[model samples]
Target: MKERNILDILGNAEEDTMEFLTEKCPEITDAELDALIDATEKKYKTKKKAKDGTEKDNNINMTENEVSGVEHSRRPAWLAPLLTAASIVLTAGVVLGSVMLLNRHGHNGGGIEQPAVTATTTSVTAAVSTIATSAGTATGTAAMSTATTQTVTAAETTAETTVYTTVPFVAPAAEKLYVDNELGSIALELFKKDDEVRYYPMGGGIECDIHDGIKFAADPELDIWCIDYSVEGDSYPAVHDIAYYCHVTDSKFSSLEEIKNYARRTMSENRYEQFFGGKMAKDIDNLEYMDTIDKEHTKFWIEYRGKLYELAYVGGWGKLPSVFSDFYPVIIADKTDTSYTAYIPLWYIQVEDINNCICVELKLILDPEFNDWRVDNVEQFDGKHYEELYNMLKG
Candidate 1:
C-alpha cells in the first residue's frame, strides 16, 4: 500500500479511506488533523463554485447550505471564530474515533489501548474552553492593574489653645498688724501688767499722798515723775522720765560688746555714717556710761536724742529703782511707708517696797534712708494709769 498524506486523505477520501489513513499514521496529532480538514473544505468549496459557474461576487447571495453543502443556520458574524474552532473540534473527533476503533479490534496488538473517542474529544474541547477562559482572566488582570494605580491625600490642619495661671495675694506688713485681730491682741498684751497696785488719774495738781509715807509728784507736760520715799527709814528722792529704749535685746547678744560688734560688722560704711552720723565707735563708746550703785551694784545707760535711757535687765539690780527682768524685742516692718519699728518691753519695778514689777513700752522707728532704728517714743502705764494712752499706741 502507498503512504498517503493526511491532507490528501481528507480532501477526496470517504469515511472508510480516512479510517485507513488514521490506522496507518497512529502518531498524527489532533492539531494536524484539524488543519487537514480546513484545507480540504477550502479546496472543495472552490471546486464546487467553479462547477456551478458561480462568480466570486454572486457567492455572497447564496444560502449557507447552498454554499457549503450543509444545513442552513443563522449566526452572528462575530461567531466566525467560534465556527472555525468548532470545525477543528469536529475534525479532531473524527481522527479520535478512528484511533479508538483500531484499538478495539486489536489490529495493533503491541500498541497501548487508546481512550474512547468521545472522552478524548471532550478533553480536547475542555482544553480549548480553558484557553479561552485563561485569555479572559489575563484581560481582567490587566484591567485590575489599571484600577490599582490610585492615590489618597490628606489636608493639613492647625489648632491653638490658651492657659491661665492664678497668683496668690499677700498682705503688707503694716496692714497685717492692723487687720488681723489675733496679731493686734498679741501686740496689746505684750505690755499688759499684772494687777497689784491700781492706776489712779490725778486732777488739780501732781501732789499725791499714798501709804508707806511715799509722795508722788508728776510733770504732766513731759510725763515725768519725782518720787520721795524712805528706804529702811532713810529718806531718798529720785527723778524719772518716760523715754524710748533700745530694743535689740531679742537678738540674744551675750554682752554689750557683742551688740556693738554686730553693728560694726554688719553695717556698711554708708550705713554706719547714716545710722551713727559718722559717730560709729566714738559715740557708741561714750554711750556706755554707767552709774554706781554703792560700788557693789551699777546701772548702765545709753544717751540718744539728748536723753539718758537705762539698760534693760537680763539679771541685775540697781539703786535708781528700776525693773529687773528679761526684755524681748520685736521688730516690725511697714512696707507701705518703707519704715520699720521695734517695740522693747521695759520691765519696771511696780512698788518700791514690794519688789513687784510691770512693763513700760518703748518704740524705735527706722526709715528707708536710715540703716538703724532710732529711739522715738515711750509709754509708761500700769493696771490703773494711762489706759487710754496704751490703747491709742496699741492701734
Candidate 2:
C-alpha cells in the first residue's frame, strides 16, 4: 500500500491520526499505543506545569505576538496534540536507528536505550522498522535489523566488551626548518606539544628521505633529548660531516663545559686542553662527580675561514673528512605513550646535481632509568617508502 503523508494527514484532520499511525505501523498493539499516548501526555503536562506565566500571558494577548496574523489564524486548535504524537513516534525511531548504527560500527556489546513503547512480546520488529522508515532512519538492512531485540543485545555486548582510553603521545607539528647551503636545499622541522617533541625531516616540500641521518639520545637524569647528525660526503664532496650527541646534567657548566669535563676526566688534562684549545678551570665544575665518560662528546667543530697558510697546508684528497657539523635537528615519524619513531633523510649533492633521497628510520623506547627515550630499532628506506611512512604517522 502507498504510504500516507503523516504531516499532510495531521494538517487535514486530527480525527484520522490514529488510523494513519495504525496503517504506518500495524505491529503496534492497542495496549502499546495507549501506553505511548499516556506517556506523551504526562510528559506534556509536566512541561506545561513548569512553564512561566509569560507564555500564558502571550496566549491571551495574541495580538502582541510577532508571527503574522494570517499564519496564526490558520493554526488548528488540535495541531498541538498531533505534534506531540509525531514527536513521540519520531523519538522512538531515533532511539532504534541509533542502536542499529552503533551495532554496525562494532559497538553492539552494550544495552541501548529502548523506545518509549512497551511491547508485550519480543515480536515488535516490524513495528520498529516501520517507525524508523517513517522517521527517515531505515536506510538499509546493513545497519537496521529485522529483530529489534537482537540489535539491542548486540549493542549492549559491544558496550560490555569495549574499553576506551586516551594514550599520551606527542603529535607532529606544522613548523618547518629549511637548509640551503653548499650541500643542497632541503627542509626539516620539529613539533612540540606539552613536554614532548616530534620531528619532520621533509616539511615544506614532498615528503622524501634527504637528510643524511638524525640520531636521538636522552639525557641520563633529565628530560632533555640530545640530537646528533651525519651528513654524507656526497653533500659537500670533500667532507662527510657528523656531530655526536651531548647532554649536560650540571647547571654549573654549559653543554660545552660538560663535554669538556668529560674530556678532562677521560684523558690527561694537558692533552685534552691542547686538542680543545682551552685551559682547564680550577672550579672542577663537573668532572669531580664523574669517574669515566666518553671523551668524543667533547669534540667541537669550527668554520675555520680565510686562506690556507703555507705552513698549515693539509693533505689527503683520497678520503673525505668524517667531521661533525655545528648542529642538526631530529625528525619524529611517529609517537606513542612510551615509544616513538624518528627519521632522517639522506641525500647528497654531487657537482650541484640532485640525487634520489634515502632515509634512516629509528624506533625509540622509553628507558626506565631517566624516563628518557632510547633507540630500539633502525631501518633505511628510499623515497618509495615515503607513502608507507606517511600513512603510519597518520594512522
Candidate 3:
C-alpha cells in the first residue's frame, strides 16, 4: 500500500491500526505507547522472576515497578530509593500491627484470667476474716463463761463454809424434871439403871408400877415413850408402852451430871464384871441367840428376871450396830444438835422369871432393822399386855 495513504487513514481510521507506524504521530505518537507497553512488560518479567522465592518476596516484587511508577508520578526523584523507604514503612506498619494484635489478644486473655483471680482472692480474704472473727468471739465467750463459773463456785463455797461454824446454847448440868401425881406426891424422872434387866439385848421397853408390885409395857421396842408417866388420867401421859416415841419439849431433862447422879440414886450403881454359866452361854457364837436377842424383833420381857437369855437385855439398840445399857433416852442439853451431850445407855439387863436384874453386858449387838429408824410401838399398841409379863412384888 501507499505509505502516504496509510498515514491519511492513521489520523482517523481503523485500517491504520494494523499498519506499522507509517510515518510518525502527528500529535500523540505510537512510539510513546509502545515504550509504555515495553516498561509494563519489564515489570511483568520481574514478577515472573519472583515466583521462584518465598511468598514475602513474591508479594514484594509482584508490583514493585508498578509501585515505582506510582511514586514517579507523584515526585520526580530517584524512585528506587523512594520505593525502598515506602517498603520499609510498610514493613514497620505490618510489624507494628502484628505487635498490636498480639497485645490485644494478650489483653483479652488476661482479662479472662484476672476476674477469676480477683474473685478467688476476694473470697479467700472474706473466709479468712470470717474464720478469724468467729474464733475470736468463741474464745472471748469461753473466757467470760469460765470467769462466771469461777465466781459462782467461789460464792457457793463461801456460803457452805459459813453455815457450819457456830453451835447452839444449852441448859445447866445439875437440874431435874418432875411430874405431879394424883396421889398428891411428886414423882421424879425415873430411869431403871439395871444393865441386866431386859428381855432382849438391844431392845427393852420401860416398866412402871402397874398397881403396887407388877410393872409391864405394851410396845417394848421404843422405850423413850415410857419415861413420861401418867397417874390414870392426869392429862393422860404421852408414852404408855415400851415402843412409844416421846415428845422432846414436853418433857424436862436434867443436866448431864444431874441425870447421872439421879440414875445412881434411883437404880443399881454397880456393873457386872463376870460372865454367866449355861450350855449356850459357854459358846456364844450361835445364831439362835441373835434371833432371840434382837430388840427390833421381840415384844416384851419379864422385868427384874435373873436369867440371861441372850435375847433379853437393853442399851445396845437404835442406829448403832453394837452398844449396852438399859437406859435409852434422848438427853437434851441443846435440843437441836446431835453433837451435844447425849446420855446413851451402854448396858443390857437380863430379866429372869423373877422381877429382878440378873445379868449385865457391857456391849450388845443391835438388829439390822434398826438402821436409820427410831422403832416405836405406839402406832400398834394393846394395853392388855401389861398384866401378862408381870412378876410383881406381892406384899
Candidate 4:
C-alpha cells in the first residue's frame, strides 16, 4: 500500500498548511472522509441559528477543493483557522468512531465494514429501553443485568411448579408397597385374590399351608368382624385358632383427626391413649404395647386374638405388628371415582399352631367433605375346612 500525500489531493491549499494538517491527523478512509465532509456541510451550510433563535440557510459551501476547479482571488481571513478547527474535529471523530467499532466487533479485522452509527444507536437505545423497563431503572445497565437473571430464575421456578401441579396422582404399584421400619422401606410381596389382598412380610405366603380358613363371626353392636383360621385341625371346631378381630363399620371420616377420634371411641377398653402413645396412663395395665409409635404407624390398632374357641373373647390378644396398621403398607386393591377397595393386613400370626397373615377386605365409599373414603362394607369370606374335606375316604 502506498501512503498518499494529503497536499497532492488539496492543491488549492498552501503547501505548509496541507503538511501541517496531514502531520497532525491520521489517514482517513474514504467512508470516514465522506462522513466528515457531510458533517461539516450540515454544520456550516443550509442552516444557521440567528440571535433571535430563528433558523435560516447561510448558503455557505466550505468543502470546495482543487478537484472542483473553482479558483478564488484569495482565501477569507477566517478560512485558515476554521479549516484547522474542522480538521482537528474530524480527526477526533474518526478516532472515537474506530474505538467504538473495535469494542463492538473485536480487533481481528481483515476488511470489516464499519456499521452505520444511526443503526447502531437505534439498536442500543431499544435494548437499553427493554432492560430499563424490566429492572425498573431508567439508566442503570448493572441493574438491568441483575433483573434479567432474576426474571430467568422466576420463569424456571414457575415452569417446575406448573409441571408438578399438572401431574396426576398415581397409586403406587402392588410390588412397591413397603413398611418403613428401623430398616428403611422393607418391601412386601403382594398376593391378591378378588378383593382379598395380602402382603407377605416374611415372604412365606406359598410355604404357609392353610388347612382351614376364613370363619367369620360378626358383632354388629361393636361393628366387629372376627375371622378365624386353623392350621392344626379344622377351621370349624378348630384345635388351635388364629383369630383376627376386625372392627369394621360404615363410617365417614372427614380427616385423619376424625379417624383418630373414631379409633379412640371404638376400642374394647379405654386403652386408646396407651396403645396410641399419647399421654400414658398412671397405672401399669399392659394389654398391648408398641416399641415406637408415631403418626405414620399409630393411626390405628388391630387386636390379634391368639386363642379363641368361638366369637366369645378368651382375652388372649396383643397389638399386631406395625406393618399391619392402616397407616402402614396398605394396598389399594381396586379404586374408582366414587369408591375403592383397600386391603389392610390386620395381623400376621406365626406361631406353633398357625402361620398366616389375616387381611381384611374393605370397600370404601368416597365422601365429599375432604375427598376421603369411608368404609362402606367389610367383605367376609366363608369358612373352608380343606383338611377335613381332603381326609374323607372314597366311597
Best candidate (score: TM-score): 2
Prediction 3 global C-alpha lDDT: 0.21
Query: Poorest 10 consecutive residues of model 4 by lDDT?
Result: 141-150
* TM-score of predicted structure 3: 0.12
Off by over 4 Å in 1: 1-359, 367-375, 383-386, 389-395
Tens digits of per-residue lDDT, candidate 2, 342-379, equal 65443321111112333444455555544644434333
Q: lDDT score of model 1?
A: 0.27
Model 4 CA deviation exceeding 4 Å by range: 1-331, 349-355, 379-395
Candidate 1 is scored at a TM of 0.17
- lDDT of model 1 at residue 203? 9
Model 3 CA lDDT for position 165: 17
Q: Worst lDDT window (10 residues) for model 1?
A: 139-148
Give lDDT tens digits, candidate 4, residues 243-313: 22112221333233443454433221222232223311121122332222222221112222331111211
Candidates' lDDT values, in order?
0.27, 0.28, 0.21, 0.26
Question: For this target, which candidate reaches the highest lDDT against the unseen true structure?
Answer: 2
Q: Over the stretch 91-194, how does candidate 1's per-residue lDDT look in tens digits?
A: 55465445534432333211111111110111011121110111111110000000011111222111111000011112224333322243323333322221
* Candidate 3 per-residue lDDT over residues 8-119, each given as its tens digit: 3335545333121211111111221222233344444454444334334324433735542222223224445544544553443343333223332232110000111100
